[model samples]
Target chain A: MGMTIAEKILARASGKSKVEPGDYVVGKIDLAMVHDLTGPLTLNVLKEIGYDRPWDPRKIVIILDHQVPANSTVTASLHQQLREYANKYGTNFHDVGRQGVCHQILAESYVKPGMLVVGADSHTCTLGALGSFATGIGSTEMASVFLTGELWFRVPETIRFELKGTLKQGVSAKDIILYIIGKMGVDGALYCATEFTGEGVERLSIDSRLTICNMAIEMGGKTGIVNPDAKTLEYTKCDSCEILRSDKDAEYQRTIEVVLEDLVPQVSLPHSVDNVKPVSEVEGIEVDQVFIGSCTNGRLEDLEAAAKILHGRKVKEGTRLIVIPASPSVYIEAERRGYIKTFIEAGSVVCNPNCGPCLGGHMGILADGEVCVSTSNRNFIGRMGSPKSKVYLVSPETAAATAVEGKLTDPLKYVRS
Target chain B: MSAIKGKVWLFGDNIDTDVILPGKYLVLTDPNELAKHALEGLVQDFYKKISKGDIIVAGKNFGCGSSREHAPLALKYAGVGAVVAESFSRIFFRNSINIGLPAVISKGARGIIKENEHISIHLDEGYILRENGEKLPIERYPDFLLEILKDGGLLQNLKRKFARRGEV
Candidate 1:
């Protein structure tokens, strides 16, 4: 008779007393985000509706990434379209260099516990780390939200992930998610809400939690939810919020308990995120590129982790290492902490916040027969560049270590004692 | 109810939206231009090899990443009949249904069908006709989704709804 976190959030957003899995309800959207890659289509659809203005301009956030600095004339025009729409409607727009990535910027300011966020990008689930219910939507669906500020939800069934024990040193939240994805396979949590709870999750930093929730989509999850705790409250400075929780007797479609103490460094092999192997197994595999960034792992902590490994070491010859902070805030923090200078001195190309190379947009695209060990999610064939190239997914620690030895080397040996 | 027939084109698990339509072509607003590049990364000459009524049969987690409607739009414009999979991503499932492309969920379908094979689907009866003449039950959807498909998609259905509202 108790409700899960997702059920409670949907019920509250829809103004209903009670709702359950499989029930369709239209919920009020608190925040909607769009970036340069998808904003033009979203704006065109809204224009087709003949809307004099947005249903609520302040409710939306727009960022120009994917092709920052205008990779091409086409991408340049896209930024223009988004800018014109934002100016005409007086919506909140984060111009180039004003922000890094949309989700990172949104979490820094907009996201709140128990809010419902629908974004135009799949990584919108990254906001779920703040204990908000968020998911991706298409341009037409975004247009509907622009016109009515409402969208439907199916009150997804919840899958409880109870993390026990503590993560080993040199192992990170990225490894935790990669291990889960490997165990469950790609379709493990299809159409379900995978909620991370228990003591281990409580100890995870906001960046780690964001990294975990960002990949919930890889398992076909509707969204990943973590109840607002002390850390959440402290970070958001939100006192006396709704603070939703699943009842002790709440029903779950599946309950997976991961023991962090036993987990070692994990690496997702080429072509598939679910194709995972322990770092020991893939040791000595040489790589041509080393990338440490994405919405999944481009936070300040991620940069710090890489910088810690590359502080006084130079990258091996024939290896290309690129570092991108998740946001301008992260970049500024890295500068203050001297991680930027340390990286440049160590032979890594530290760029601004953008989705470059992750989706093959720009920056460090790979060539045929090349191999890259990356901190980003999704290692699908040709994800970074040529289909003949290979991508190995690892933690920032492993990426930095690999960049040094020019092979797949675990950072555990190189971590400061 | 009519039985839709098509030749099967097989694929494995997790055929994401990005592979269906790569990010490189996302800038092109034209659906026809997108169709030309459909599955071209994995399958060379994908658009040319696809028959008008060819159906795609894949393993679990089909259309997994990204919510771009351009994905299903590419397949629709490329003349794919329907996508039969073991499971599908939630957003991609809804996008495909709204776009009026039949996305049938038939468990163990990958083992049942092979490349370039023929299969038949009974939309009303919720079953698939294997080449060996065996019937496999499919997960049935709400009548409303079929109603939308019958009227040729959500866009057309919206037109009908607005027309009816004017009469009221």
Candidate 2:
């Protein structure tokens, strides 16, 4: 039977017919996730349903990144609940402290080509970077997966984003996505699948693809995918899994292309991810906080890029710069490269590996009327604490440079060649 | 239950799940406790002022986030009469119906309604009546979904379905 990449994968896993966008199908899940915050509730639900054993222990991954190190009593309690559940259920991966955000850890370790991954967190779309059709579900659904190893989905219409041209120096993939959001608006990709391809995407690294797919939720996309390539294979280390590309005549609901050769660093103004403009247009917008962490850009490459600009420099007085590595492995890698030292020497506060300050859980929360430039996805009101606090979404380079300057600036101005 | 009457509060697009129930409060299990935090992130003290049977009017993409059933549970516990949005996050919309909450979609909600305005929602009729007597049509719920809501959430509905199947 003829099939698109998504249809082929779902059909194999779900044992369903040729699936198309908007067609509801139920399939076995290749993977499922739960974290400290939501694990207890899921456990409680499972108990209520009287499921003595999980459908497959190997497919479940439990994590404690939301409040890593248990900063408070509540967080500590949440962690305990997760540990208990993982122990009882025999979860395959129990990532704790600095292990990194769930999405990053999954991408680094388990996510592979053609897998259907689902998590209880929205950013689970990060696994789409590995050519998996991954998306987020809720605790109850996760509980169901734990019981039956299966879930249902309605196929989504596919929107093709064709990128062309090489990115300019100091302009990262984050900037490119920000630019796309600027053009398409926050709701542009709502309820659709975003398929990235073309010359521009081919030039980006796997980590960069993770960054792009990670933020698909901001555009309201169900998930995002890129045709697996050499780089994707290298990153995932999946030699045995087959790599699927869109058929030459594959159908798409819509297509949009971007030329990256002349693209500048982009910034998404506060209150909405789609409220974007070029960095030059919003220069001199003073910032009180600068954060470089979250599943999106908290990888090793992201830290290295930020440290290169922060070396031997001091952050602007009155500004708080927070850098959190996405995972413990990323933290170790950064430490080995002395990136952490450079960041601290530059007057930045380095936090443990976790999704700190990105979702306003803990650390780096902005004060009322304050402005922060963050590398995380989503700058919606109260996203980082206090609805009055404004957040500007930008690339790590822009975030680092702005931390030093206390305003939005091009990182090229300070980066050493 | 007594006939609930209240005014409708209308909002514009992209009302995410985070706004309805902040991620920070997801730990709480009590629906009443969660009800107090509903929309706390956006409109401070929303729960404290909300009366029984008040309605929410919003533009597209309402209830989008980690499909915590708590979202609709909190809204229902807060005594919300019905929710009218232009569009909805797929899971949240389904969960609302599964939990017996009245969630309707209407294109004209944003243009005609205001925050804290007095109105009446006729669930069976699938329309909202404004103080000025303007009636806005809403998408009617499917028969199955309405039946599930009437039975008070999916778990109860599922139990009934299984019991009937067992007898057969």
Candidate 3:
């Protein structure tokens, strides 16, 4: 009869002693985030409703990421609107140079354990890696949250992913998630909370855990979470915060066993995130571009992993490589560590800290008939550009390897050798 | 809620937000302008083909990617009466309801409905009626969500709440 971590969090937030799945409750929000693309729309709703100010400005975060530096006049105007709103309301705002992907910014500083967080971007679920109950909401719903400082929820059932065994070399968190997504189609986890636990989770770094949780939405999860442990505490720099974990007898709708040793470098084929396969099965397919960035895989560790592969090699002449750090802090750290230099020397353009090309909004959009190997989540049609183009989702290791060969080459060859 | 009648536009599984409205168009706040690009990732000029009061009938997991309200707004502005899928991504379902667009879940929607077929949905009655008079059950909204829908959307509902509080 013990409640899962998700139930406990919702219970605490809703001021209830217990909450079961399918039970509707209105929960107080701890953090609410909005980004450039969705922020403008949310602000427009507030404008329409004649709501003058947010209920709690300090708890609200406004970040500019998706179309940073103003892709066009329209985007620039949108940025202006968000800035004015933030300045007027005294909300915590991250502007152009200070901004990163909203989720990355939240992970780097704001997210903490046992909190309820909501953001207007789908990848807001990324912060659930830190053990908070974070999920994505639409702009309109976010506007409501901004006004009332609360939102309604139907407590979702939990699906515990029992990860076992250590991941082999050249395979990583991305591979494990891709393997799971392939098994559980896109809707496999629809409306359910995904709790990642077990030995393999302990083996993963916070970055890797974030990568895993970042793709929860791709598999239709309401949120993906990892119980806070030593590594999570270290990453969040919270030595004394209360850590949330599922009880031993916590009720889960189902338990899925993900054996890490069985995983290889995995890739999601074009037009669908669940159309996954081992890199070897689709090897040697030509690629025109390689992108190693986005909220999903643009961390410093991702940069280092890709840089290690491209250290002494040039990108294939016909292939274009673009490396973007997820946040400014990550960018500075990567630069200080020489990963930026390695990427640049390897013929890849090291871009600014923003959501470059992941949303197909800027920087590295693909032309028609182009094929790209990217580390970002979601490979839906036209995700990176032309509907005729294709995207294969992989880890930073596989992306760099593919950049070197100008095709879908497995990373084991590069890393093992 | 009154009954809504619309022609069906059938689609397959996992029709993501990108196919509903690509990221490049996210900057546009105008729903009509967004409607111009609706489903263009799946079909060219799809909006032009949609008549007013048409409904989107699809297989599992329609609206599966992104938290863009523009997706549902585009469909609604393109004159889509409702979207009845086997299932929907969570955020998309919320976005649809928040924007006054109806997102229904009918397990047999795709099986019983054909493209361009006229169908009527009785939201209050919790069923879809095919032209052949086949009654398909649909998931009904909870009372609180129904209140939001009755007020036209979350925005209007908030407006009313603000007026009630004299906070507007």
Task: Pick the lDDT winner.
Answer: 3
Mark the regions of model 1 whose C-alpha exceeds 4 Å error after superposition. A47-52, B1-4, B129-134, B157-168
For B1-168, candidate 3 gives per-residue lDDT tens digits of 888899999899889999899999999999999999999888788888988999999999899999999999998998898999999999999999999998999997798798899999998999999999989999999988888888999999999999999988
lDDT of 1 at A177: 96
* Regions more than 4 Å wrong, model 2: A1-3, B1-7, B65-70, B98-102, B113-151, B157-168
Q: Which docking category, incorrect, acceptable, medium or high, applies to candidate 3?
A: high
> Which of the numbered candidates is closest to the native, going by highest TM-score?
3
RMSD of each: 2.3, 3.1, 1.0
What would the per-residue lDDT of candidate 1 be over residues A335-384, giving only the tens digit for each residue? 99999999999998988898778888789888899998989888887788
In candidate 2, residue A225 scores what lDDT? 87
Find the 10 residues in a row with the least total lDDT in model 1 chain A.
A44-53
Off by over 4 Å in 3: none
* Winner by TM-score between candidate 3 and candidate 2: 3
Per-residue alpha-carbon lDDT of candidate 3 for residues A1-82, written as tens digits (9 for 90 to 100): 8988888899999999989999999999999999999999998899899875888999999999998899899999999999
lDDT of 2 by residue, A305-406 (tens): 899888888999988999999888888999999999999899889998888988778887777999989999878667788778898999999999999899
Query: Model 1 residue B99 lDDT?
Result: 70
